[model samples]
Target: MALNENEVLAGLAEIVAEETGIEADQVQMDKSFTDALDIDSLSMMTIVTLAEEKFDVRIPDEDVKDLLTVGDAVKYITKAQA
Candidate 1:
């Protein structure tokens, strides 16, 4: 079964928290991953890996750059599943 949007969001939040040393709840949906979470390129790539593993989907490298926020990541994963 494909993961739902909420699940994707939650998973991403967890990944962000684990990788960035921030609390999962601190990650707002609208907040920029880079600015809010202080995520650098290496961290972002780790997030992409975690997302792909959790959702069982492959995200392209080019698309990774576009996922700047939690909402963006959710949208990308939801779209990929569809």
Candidate 2:
């Protein structure tokens, strides 16, 4: 099953919240994973891995570098689901 942008974003927000303790609502599409969310490389990797599991999509390490903001990740995961 594929998830829409909102669903993906919400699920991702949950993951980000769990990992960083940031409120899920704060994980907005414009928020940068590194700057806005204060996610380090290690935490980012963990989030990516967990996202893959949750969304059932494969987000390659190389691709992870390109996902700078919450929207980027939501778009990537949404496309990967297809």
Candidate 3:
């Protein structure tokens, strides 16, 4: 089954909360994972790994640039799942 933006967002929220110690409720689609959440490269890599496992999507290293924001992550994973 293909993933949707809302579903991606929810999954990402859980990932972000677990990885960054940020509250899931505070994870907004408009927020930037690096700027807003202070997710460094290492943490982002971990997030990507967990997201790939959780959502069954392969987020290539090159594609990592496209997932700067929460909404960007949702869109990328949703597309990958599709």
Worst 10 residues of 3 by lDDT: 2-11
Q: Model 2 Cα displacement at 1 (Å)?
A: 1.9
Candidate 2 on 3-35: residue-level lDDT in tens? 999999999999999998999999999999999
Local accuracy of candidate 3 as per-residue lDDT tens digits, 1-82? 9877898899899998999899998889999988988899999999999999999999999999878899988988898898
Regions of candidate 3 where Cα sits further than 4 Å from its true position: none
For candidate 1, the TM-score is 0.91
Q: For candidate 2, give the lDDT of residue 47.
A: 97
Each prediction's TM-score against the native? Answer: 0.91, 0.98, 0.95
Question: Clashing residue pairs in candidate 2, if any?
Answer: none
The candidate with the higher TM-score, 1 or 3, is 3
Candidate ranking under TM-score, highest first, comes to 2, 3, 1
Per-residue lDDT of candidate 1, residues 1-82 (tens digit): 7777888888888888888888998877798988877889998898899888888789999988888888898988988887
Ranking by lDDT: 2, 3, 1
| Candidate 2 weakest ten by summed lDDT | 55-64
